[model samples]
Target: MSRITTVFDKLRQQNRKALIPFITAGDPEPALMVPLMHELVKAGADILELGVPFSDPMADGPTIQRSSERALKYGVGLKDVLSMVEEFRKDDTGTPVVLMGYANPVEAMGYETFAARAKASGIDGVLTVDYPPEESEEWVEHLNRQQIDAIFLLSPTTPQARVEQVAKMAQGYVYYVSLKGVTGAANLDLRDVADKLIRLRSRIPIPIGVGFGIRDSMAAKAVAELADAVVVGSRIIEEIENSAKENILTNVYRLVRSLRSAIDEAGSKH
Candidate 1:
């Protein structure tokens, strides 16, 4: 099994959901990236999604946009991100690292080359926001050949047919955008999320991770009750944005610890 599948299987047996945390690579500061990644795992993150800084992050909100901008200012590109992952692997080989970003950088690096480099760097998954399943056949093939999961996104507006298409092509877990808008959009409406998850569960066989609007422990716990994982990005980015460099690690750790506690409570109830 892939590292992702193995982690999900273990979580299932323990009746606990995954806590997947995202951080823009080289955000806050380029020198802090690897340390921050290790801190997240220590803070109870099951899977880690490292955002690749892009010039125009269409899917991200202002918080993450700023993060990408900060990283870009430091000249942190795909290779730098991959090097970070390689450094992270020196200490952590168990936790899966998923690269979350746009398609432009990958295209520049080329699919096969990117996949080969990603695998060598110990990356376990890739979730390109703009890569639709209809056009991802060869891309998915390339990553699959490298034994890296090509993860996909499913929003509330995704058609049923497309969900099935994604189910066929995607590996690891499916990311369900809990809100209709971009990342950090508010008004979660767990009732709507629950209803949608019922349909998604009927379609997607692998684990489902809910994100986009889960900004606090309450929403994280509620979504944890329904999905296989809870992915928190923007709120964490906001934490990074406001904290002093010396305290960013501690502040983020505390936030994730609280969310982890809430999600664990939900699993106990489950």
Candidate 2:
């Protein structure tokens, strides 16, 4: 089984919700990227979503946008992010790492090449923000050949027909963008999210993870109540943005630990 499937299966067997945290790989600096990834796992992350910094990240809000900018300033590219993952695997081998980014970089590197390098570097999944499911046949085919999960995004406005299309192609898990707005937007209605998941789950056999505006432990716990996984991104980047270089790892670890604790508390009831 793929690392992602194995992790989700293990979570299901343990009756625990997955705590998946996202970080823009090479953010803060290339030197700290691998360490940050390891720290996230240490802090109780069941899976890691590592962002490949893109120039035009339209789906991302200010926090993630700034993260990409910082990483790009140091000339970090897709290859650099993959290298970081490889370095990360030298010490930790089990945690699943999903690359979250735009499609341009992948297109530049070529899908077949990206798939090969990604699989070689210990990547388990890929979520390209703009790669709609309908047009991803060849893209998905390549990842499938490499055994890498091609995760897709589903928003509140997505239609049933589109959802079905995504379900047919998406592997790993489908990311449900809780808010209609970009990554950091607020006003997340848990009931609304729960309602959507109920319908999507009927069509999608894979696990559903809700992200966007999930900024704290309470929000994480609430999402964990209904979704198979709770994805925290902007909030963690906010943590990274606020902390000093020396304290970034510690601060992020503590925040993720609290989130994991809260999610696990909710999972125990199920």
Write out the backbone clash pairs for model 1.
none
lDDT at position 17, candidate 2 = 96
lDDT of 1: 0.94
Residue-wise lDDT of candidate 1 within 197-245, one digit each (tens)?
Answer: 9999988989999999789999999999999999999999999999998
Residue-by-residue lDDT tens digits, candidate 2, 1-270: 989999999999999999999999888999999889989999999999999999999988999999999999999999999999999999999999999999999999999999999999999999998889777999999999999999999989999998998898889999999988989788898889988988898999998899999988899999998899999999999999999999999999999999999999885433
For model 1, state the Cα shift of residue 214 in Å.
Answer: 0.8
Per-residue lDDT of 183 in model 2:
90
Models, CA RMSD each? 1.0, 1.1
Which residue runs of candidate 2 sit more than 4 Å off their true CA positions? Answer: 267-270
The residue ranges of model 1 lying beyond 4 angstroms of the native Cα positions read: 268-270
